[model samples]
Target: MVQQWDIVKIIGAIALPQMGGWVNGYLTRQEIKGWYQNLNFPSFRPPNWIFAPVWTSLYAGMGYASYLVWRDGGGFSGIAQGPLFLYGTQLALNWAWTPIFFKRHELKWSFVELAALTATVAATGFAFFNINKLAGYVFIPYFAWCSFATLLNYKIYKLNPESTATIEEVKEPKKKTN
Candidate 1:
């Protein structure tokens, strides 16, 4: 039995991450383009087009998982606040990583943020299990993706130590065209 708030919970879950994705895209549009075109990415990198669909699906899963917990009356109303709070915290951390990495160009700190996010996700999943085991299961893929992303962030950081500089901070020597 889905309540009206259930839909809102689900939407909130997905929308929050979607908002993060939007901010990431909006703020990093040029950086993202230049990354693909210019950076020495790790060999295992996926096509840029792949990120949209993958994140969309993952966000859906996250939202559904959260909806299950929220609908079960496990959020602020029950003993589940700790877990949900962890969930919310991780989501915020997830949101901030983009700006840290792209806008501020803090690859090293971005990786640190990812590490915190990974820990938070795990705590949230474990907390979710206490309330709804199925909800805990839903986060498995999200957890996996974050783990993979941590490694990817590290690789990117290693590949482009110069990326620490914001676009304006680093000056490129101009090439003369014929």
Candidate 2:
């Protein structure tokens, strides 16, 4: 049987990842301030401001799903841990992606990473469904967002393969006037 403290621990573990992701996301926003403003984003791109609220809600859902799994006790037996582990792994990857894409400006690598993250999240969702239906449902928005992000990353990479440079590098150029 799972105690309340166990539930708290699971929620805490899940929240830690989400909080880290949120902070990294904020930093990425700061790093890409002007870059996003200048990009040739797709027509399907949501307004820039929409991301904050969307992510916040998604993270909340993730946290709740974790709590559910944690409270389920033996409910997490067998392959149940699969979803939880994948959930955490994908969250970590997701958090790292913003720094790679925005801070390092590695659009190509970012595209690949985002694709992997999307696949992991999809797998997590499927695994979670076997453990808890609602838990799986909670990840839908997260999976959807990653899918959209993968498309965006690919477009950005295609649009500017040679544009992979740190913000500082992009701002500086060698003089060559003859």
Backbone clashes for every candidate come to 0, 0
lDDT of 2 by residue, 120-162 (tens): 9898888777778898898898898889889978887777766
Estimate TM-scores for all models: 0.84, 0.80
| Model 2 TM-score, all chains together | 0.80
Regions of model 1 farther than 4 Å from truth: 3-5, 166-178
With candidate 2 superimposed using the best TM-score fit, by how many Å does residue 132's alpha carbon deviate from the native?
A: 0.6
Q: Which candidate ranks first by lDDT, i.e. highest?
A: 1
lDDT of each: 0.79, 0.77
**Candidate 1 vs. true structure, TM-score:** 0.84
Which run of 10 residues does model 1 get worst, by summed lDDT? Answer: 166-175
Task: Assess the local accuracy of residue 130 in candidate 2 as a C-alpha lDDT between 0 and 100.
Answer: 73
